[model samples]
Target chain A: MNPLDKPYAQLALAVLAVLVLPLFLKSGILATEILIFAMVVAACNLLLGYTGLLSFGQGIFFGIGTYAAGICLTRWQIPVPVVLASAAVLGAATATLVGWLSIRRQGVYFVMLTLAFSQLFYFVAYTFSGVTGGDNGLLGVPRPSVGGTALNAPWSYYTYVAVCFVAVFAILVMVTQSTFGRTLLAIRENEGRAAAIGFPTKLFKLEAFAISGAVTAFGGALHAMLIGVAPLSNIEYHTSELILIMTIIGGSSSLFGSVLGAGFYLLLADALSTVWPRWLLLLGLVLVTVALFLQRGLWGLVERGYDLVFRRERAPETPAEEH
Target chain B: MTDIALQTRGLGVKYGNFHALAEVDLQIRRNSVHSIIGPNGACKTTLFHALTGRVRASSGRIELDGRDITDTSDDDRVRLGIARSFQVTSLFPNLALRENLRLAAQGRTPWQALAPWRRAEANAEALAIADEVIERLALAPVSNRLAGELSHGQQRRLEVGMAMAARPRVILLDEPTSGMGIDDIEAMKQLIRDLGRDHTVLFIEHNMGIVMNISDMVTVMRLGRKLVEGPPAQVRDDPEVQRAYLGNMITGDIA
Candidate 1:
């Protein structure tokens, strides 16, 4: 069967996979880590794949979310739900500022603008040691409590994180299936025609950026809760590059590919680091192979395999290289 | 005898030291087929851009039904009942034919974005319009095909269908039949005739046969200025039109 022809069936399969993953994994913590990054990768897919924009500054919003959650828990002693909501708002606000200024240009100029702004935010976080904790980073963040009991146990926290992941994923799925989402796809395919047909494309693009930033930031907040520490590295350019690589390796436009990509990248890194000090060299080689041979990433390979097994006529490959 | 559908006075556009269009005065009447004809580099496309607000006019006033709309933005111009098709067949190439038509039909209602669950009536309206355009353009057989995968003639027809899907009162089509087979040209001419029954059609055409057969009024441009404007028969016999298009096939049938 053609997987793209049956989106609902594909979605059900993905949900089932996510539900049963924690039962088979050796460490729930690693699974939780993969889930969190999967949310960020899904956010990237909305902008990069559906909207045809390549933003290199997603880490800034992610960092802001982490810092917001850490400060609220440590300084004010606020409840966990409130902290997450506030972090999301902060991320959306930051995205509005950056997207408004950066979207004035197109192509490589737009990429450079996002990179420059992200670097600027990184230095600001680095310089303000008293507020952000500088190189030491913020420490001693609290685990959330429901009613009177704290979810201090690993599996208990994993369940809570998993719930958050499912909620975010559901919302993103709804968004991508809506009329607004179709408009974004139209813009991605042809901006000039979208405008000629009476769409305020610039406004649509900005709102998309804001939504992407907010979701990624929410994922970052959940991550801080899982680790109890908001490190300086989370905001660095390396994290931004890592997130981009994961999104591409999974598949650009497919939401399910986000989870698969994050799991593949993180699990491979964790497994290889134990044996080899230069593990990234191997990852780099794999990435090159995927880029050249499988333009749609790992998901594209899976679809091809499905077609090979079940059908004789192959579907035309999606033109993912244009972006 | 018909009210003026669109009028431009002293319309001019310049690029640094070069003048692309200079002091053009044009008027298109309601419910008529008007075609602009000129040799290459005569600024027919540039004038179209100024009319659609795609390019800023150095000096001009564009009036749509007696309203000054030179200051209107591109998208706002579309919303105000003016739609355009590009010369290069601009379309959502990766999307299906129906999806492209639907996007053009629903571009004005951005408020639908506020909620996930769309209004049934709005979606129904867009779909109905898209379906109608598809049947009219005879694209039902390949409605599920990606626009990029279609042949040049089919893509050109889809481009026109996209503009019509928006339900505009006036259409500015840039070379709608630029590169089409003879059968496609006849089909396009019939479609334009049908559209002229209710809406104003302002098109740029190089085909002398189609222009002479279909246009109610014709404007010929040369060197960024209007050479002549009259009925097609009057224009084909104008002495100045012959002088401007000398050694060009556009004037070959003038005598």
Candidate 2:
């Protein structure tokens, strides 16, 4: 077995990334954004990688969390913990509704339903200009206070988000190792057989959606605080696409792959956008290359590197067995 | 509570004018090996589907231990102690053989199956059930291997083992030995005989030899209807059973 397939190894890699990012990058904001997105992409993996669901409506939950933080922090001055919890609750509720409706169909229809729901949510956020702050979004979203002082410095906020990131990552890892996670794999491998084995397959799928949405929204809340604005783009179709791209690019096979994916995209964007304004054209090329060669994404490359260094024979191909 | 472990009365399935199965009645006794044997297009599989609630019955009453369960969903049917294997080998291919059986064993308790906070391996009961099934199916040697990586014969055994893992009161095997060599067939026959000792075993088989030797009762289906059903000796001696297989090549095996 690959040593990296263990949950501890994955968690170790996550911690290493969090600790190592600040040393290499000058921008604390960029480092913090990567961590937030890493969590979001990992949540997406819970659906795509484990449960065999490709949800385009993830941004709906993320945006909901962003707005939850934006509205509560700006107007009501709710405690940070309460706001975060509310975001998760709202995200889970929305996901349950969407999952219940979408899972009635399978395959392409299911994918289409999620995509349509994404559009539906985007328009609702757009139409309710008062609550969503229209195009301007809710601005001046203050950072959480730590010991009677606001985390005004980017690095200080990074420290706060890092702690949350580790906690969330550890929880996600634990969840993926659980019986519920195993059943999601079973459902992904064969839904019909899973049902025959006596699982209420639809309910399980909905539960997965709920967990994914909750985690994604929590990340969304963190993202809002990092940027200091609940931007309209957070709930847009493009945000959904971006999260999915990171998930695929990192490889859906492992949770740490989500980190690699988010980090790779952000780092590449950071490096290239200054050199060329249309860096997205270059990103498109990279995506195509990933699709053609690295079907398992950057994590697959990492696994190959480990295999080569250790001189171990490559194990037989299996779906992601670890978080 | 009753001699009948599973029962169906006036069971019929239709696809807009074509009757896949029609007016079929079955009373599978408790702890007996009942084999359904028939030619292709005889709807042997359809009957299994109806009993297991995979396919909706057009007209019928399905009873489990004398309780009506006609409208029960497939998963609920399994929860009611009815488990079935497919005519085709169906398993969680990416999962280990142990995991495949564990999922089946865990299916009996869905609340535990959805407990995300705890490790799946911590469920000692499910693991024990999987290990027991692996031992029974003689798959212990490769229990850690992925289901997709196993040989065809091994996968077939795993298929049956998955159903047994559910610990169901009524177990349905749809063409359990569809493709098997002599030794594997003999092994499967023995396994089914042993299974019948404790669980009600309903199987659809093309192998007449296994049916004749192992089955307590034989049910012959022809063109979506029951032609004959009785003890193996009685079924083999029936003229109607002989006539139904007269033009078919399987008639030679029946003789």
Candidate 3:
């Protein structure tokens, strides 16, 4: 059965879960972090999982959105929705430029090209400390007000981020279930065969890159408003590495996997850092185990478990999520 | 001869200092199964590559039904009613057999591919074509199975089925019966013979028995040059073909 049969109902339940999550934790901070980063991981999933293009420069697009939102809100006094829209546009434009130059190459070269382009973005932002505030970051970016009321409370901001998160998530799920997405899967399987069948694979890859960049930037914009700073750390290589790790951990090509991955990594890091100074060592070991044992990531494990318990004949991998 | 479906004039390919194919001229008549048989180094595959625009000819003019398409891209060649199967089986292994054929069929009509809603509307034309091909190739039982999981013979049939999915005026088959047993070879030979009734079929084959049996016309190549071209019987009787194939070592069994 097609798993995407009732996306609206699934989304409503998801939103409901987020609404009650803060009650159990007593702090909405981690929940908010999960929501924002889930969007980022989903964007990464678009390129890496679906299109089969591993871009290490996704952080640059997110950083661009964060910086753009910060500049608009702090200096120009732009409203919330407009700033977010501008950030998305800026991210898409950068991704288009980078994708055009990088898509010509494949495999390791593709990864290196994106990495180099991101470094270029990082240095550019670093050099313009006057505008970017460099190491100090663009601090005190305001949480948006909805129709004259400031979203100062944690729950209020969580509601705002959750709404944005759900909308983008639904859009992504639709895309993955689309014909264009199938073509991307075809390209991922055999690019030569895809082209021989009359698909312009490069053009498809570019479209994927643009869409992924826009969503990631939108997530970054929301993140900046939530944390009250457009920090340099958002653009750094380390952030890119973390996002890539989350994508793999959740499972490549699975959208729900993206959310599961981002939340798992973020929560683990948050909880572990309090107990140990070198918490990453444990995280690294966990990642190794996941990579070695569960190549499909946590999502594949979930599917395997579902198959075993239900005793349903395992079918070919479909784009839709089970949950 | 009937009207020329495909013609190449002085087609040549150079790799640095070596000549992969040189000074080759040929004609593939409409609605005829033409087999290009040669040794491994005779550049039969290179000639196919040039025809499909997989590799640019260093010097040549390729005409498809009276229009020059020497500079066309591979995918454009497919659009212009030309399709080819690889020497090695090329398929989307993870996808179902039906989906592989559907992908090929859908390539002809790409307008609906971007519209996700339209994609689910059941592309009747593509589905019909895929269904017909699956039945014709006897892949009905395994239609839902992944292409990679199929037996080698089934995979070979699917590869050719994918080429036919394009509804090409001219279909290129590179060793369709390679590595098949006697039974599979006979089946493939019958399929090619049937295919010749409607489509301009061109193939490269190492097996002289199948080529000599099924092909209406044959071209023999030696070291990137056309050594002989004529009817299957006429080419089979040529002394040059015998000497070229290690003095009757290649053609002795078939003739």
Candidate 4:
């Protein structure tokens, strides 16, 4: 069976992640950030890990989703649910267009295409000072409410995010482990072979990118709703790279790794910001060190350990010299 | 008389000044094991690629089941009941053997694209199909084993099995017996012989003994052109084949 057959388990984990993390986190704000960022990592993993396409424009969609929601409640007076939905659709639509163009090329060209398009979004945002507020960004974005009940408390908002994460995580897990996922894996293993097998290889990859973009955007929109504004700095190429680093460094094997990576990275960054105050330098140092030392990342190492233990257990049980 | 399965007319493929395949003409029949043999750079793989839609033929049209398929992509070819196995083993190395065969059997479709969602039923079917294929290939023990961990010969059989799962009307095997030792070659030859039941097979083999024993017809090539085509017995007796291979054998250590 596709590993994602257990949608309930994955959903439970997503919920458990949000609910349980508060035990360790000193502040409700920190807990919410950690959960949302974990979502960002999982979305990145869908592209980089399973599909074998490393996209660098995820933040563009994330930031765009944030801006869409921000602009909706503040400028257009749209309902919070309507704003979130519109933002998600916008993020997915933009990603589809970018992915359609980007998936055509292979190797370095794919990476360059995503990076170039992401920068294009940044420039567009920077140039359109009217709607986007240029660098200043929109303020007083509305909070999600159900029947005049404001979901404004940290736990309330965190629960909302938790529910959304659970759904997205379940959907992504299904996408990753399904027959469609197998096609993506085939593409990753060998693009030429996958094409020869009669796959519309590029299109499948593009769809993955689009979905991945949508998820990232969902997280970003939620983050903006929680924080009150969407800044251009939040969706730049650097932000995309940070998500990539988190996914790869934490492990791209399972969606579980994604959550772990996001939490650890955010925690590290939070610790650095408190002490030295120059957080970016601390993050850069950590990313470089992890990249240099652990090419497989943290989850990769854990998987290796798991495999070693299992192999040892199975070794003596073989009935005969197996073929 | 057997009808033509694949026919190419006035086909020319060139990379720069070099003619990889130069205006070659050939007719391959249905239900026959048609083997292409030649010296290095004889354009066997290039021809296979063009036939299976890997490389675009600079000039000429390809016909499948007497229908034009010149512009069809490889996946479309598979849907049209044409399939191919690579010279090298290609599969999801992490997944079990059954999953690989299931994907092949499923082919590539929108339903299959949504496969990850239908986990319970799709996976069970994939596993069942994998087990059937494994049992058919006498690889039942390796049903749960990782594809990357399988032996070279097992991998070869699995590759062929993957193609078989596509349920192709015609199967193309590129150098199926390329790197096998003597024993492995014989096993591979039997595997191919068993596979001859359902579909027409087109393959290339460097080792003449295996080619002579298995192929119903032979297409000989030299320097990007079809040197000759005939029954194995007649092609074996041809003076041109003797001269081409003999010339290389005496001059080249392979003789």
lDDT winner among the candidates? 2
CAPRI band for model 1: medium
Show what share of the native A-B interface contacts model 2 retains.
Answer: 0.85
Q: For all the candidates, what are their Cα RMSDs to the real structure?
A: 3.5, 3.1, 4.0, 3.3
Number of clashes found in candidate 4: 5
User: Positional deviation of B10 in candidate 4, in angstroms?
Assistant: 1.5
lDDT string for model 2 (A262-303, tens) is: 999999999999999999999999999999999999999999
Question: What tier of docking accuracy does candidate 2 attain?
Answer: medium
Provide DockQ values for all models, in the order shown: 0.51, 0.62, 0.42, 0.50
| Candidates sorted by DockQ, best first | 2, 1, 4, 3
| Best prediction by DockQ | 2
Error of 2 at B118 (Å): 1.8
lDDT of 4 by residue, A1-323 (tens): 23322456556666777778878776777788888888888988888888888899888988888888877778777877677778778888988998998988888998999999989999999899898888898877767886789888887787787778777787887877667877777778777766666677777887787788788888889888888787877778888988888898787767777887888888888888889878888788777877898766776666667667655565544532345
Please give the TM-score for the first chain of candidate 3: 0.92
B1-255 per-residue lDDT for model 2 (tens digits): 989998989989987899999889999999999999888889999898889888999997999999999999999988899998898999999999999999999999887778789788888999999999989888887888889988888999999999999999989998888887778888998899999987999999988788888888988898899888999888877876676573443332432
Clashing pairs in 1: none
Ranking the candidates on lDDT from highest down gives 2, 3, 1, 4
Candidate 4, residues B65-107, lDDT tens digits: the string is 7898988877788888788888877777877677677777766
**Candidates sorted by TM-score, best first:** 2, 1, 3, 4
Candidate 1 regions exceeding 4 Å error are: A4-7, A313-323, B113-122, B246-248, B251-255
Clashing pairs in 3: none
In candidate 2 the C-alpha lDDT for residue A72 amounts to 95
